[model samples]
Target: MIHKLVTTPMNLVIKVGEKVKEEADKELYDLPTIQQKLIQLQMMYELGEISEDAFKEKEEELLIRYEVAKKKEFEQWEELTKKKD
Candidate 1:
């Protein structure tokens, strides 16, 4: 028995691709959860979405949060590894 292949149109392919990207975006990255948000804010600043002062303030806040999260993640990983050793 021969199986026939169905060809997908370009528009359908693009729509499906976009939906897959949207679904993937819903899942959070494991490291530095706030990193993306920080970058987004930085980009907005670069794009002139807000004033320099406001951008600086938000950048500082996000950076501090990112550092704290990174440290906590490191500590937790170290503890888990130590247990295995």
Candidate 2:
């Protein structure tokens, strides 16, 4: 009983942390969010706020994230269709 009492709060905290991380990941890799960041990056480049090298590096990272987001969206759609069928 004492062990359960000690572990219960810890387990709850861990679960909450996992849930928060999952939500953060979803937002971070969201397609629209990535696209908005890309547009902002482009604007910065055009305004000469960021160097070409820095813009390119950030652009590449965002593009990679966009691709991953697309793939994940497709997979989720497929799963939903499979469930319906």
Candidate 3:
């Protein structure tokens, strides 16, 4: 009983922290942010701030991120459409 009492608060805190982190991550990696990041990467490459190899790597990473965000957005839209139908 004592152990359960002591652990319950900690468990609750952990769960809440996880939920907050998940939401924060979703916001952090949203489409517009990813797009802006790609633009920044391009500008960096053009201005000699980043090398061609680094630019390619970062661009690919951002493109993948954008695709993931787009996929999630499409899934959400499909869900809403299904609900309406």
Candidate 4:
């Protein structure tokens, strides 16, 4: 009936939002991926594949990106907590 029609669309929208949030969570809190990139940068520097300046520059960029990701993660956690309460 009308109730079913109304709730169906609402449910679909909620489910879609949940899926998007899950995907975002993966990208935002992906620590392992960040760590691997850091390791690669270190290896490149140690192997003399890149100069000190390049290494420092890349490392700084990566660290900044990690910081932003951590911020996003924190914000997302707070949002979820608020929703639960």
Worst 10 residues of 2 by lDDT: 24-33
Residue 15 of model 3, lDDT score:
100
lDDT of 1: 0.75
Per-residue CA lDDT of model 3 for 1-85, tens digit only, reads 9999999999999999999998987876688888889889999999999899999998998898888888889999999999999
- Measured by TM-score, the strongest candidate is 2
Clashing pairs for model 4 are none
After superposition, which runs of candidate 4 have C-alpha atoms over 4 Å from their true positions?
1-29
lDDT of 1 by residue, 34-59 (tens): 77887899899999999999998988
lDDT scores in order: 0.75, 0.96, 0.91, 0.89
| TM-score, candidate number 4 | 0.64
List, residue by residue over 3-85, the lDDT tens digit for candidate 2: 99999999999999999999998987899899999999999999999999999999999999999999999999999999999
TM-score of each candidate structure, all chains considered together: 0.60, 0.91, 0.79, 0.64
By lDDT rank, best first, the candidates go 2, 3, 4, 1
Worst 10 residues of 3 by lDDT: 24-33
Clashing pairs in 2: none
Clashing pairs in 3: none
Q: Residue 35 error for model 1, in Å?
A: 1.5
Per-prediction backbone clash count? 0, 0, 0, 0
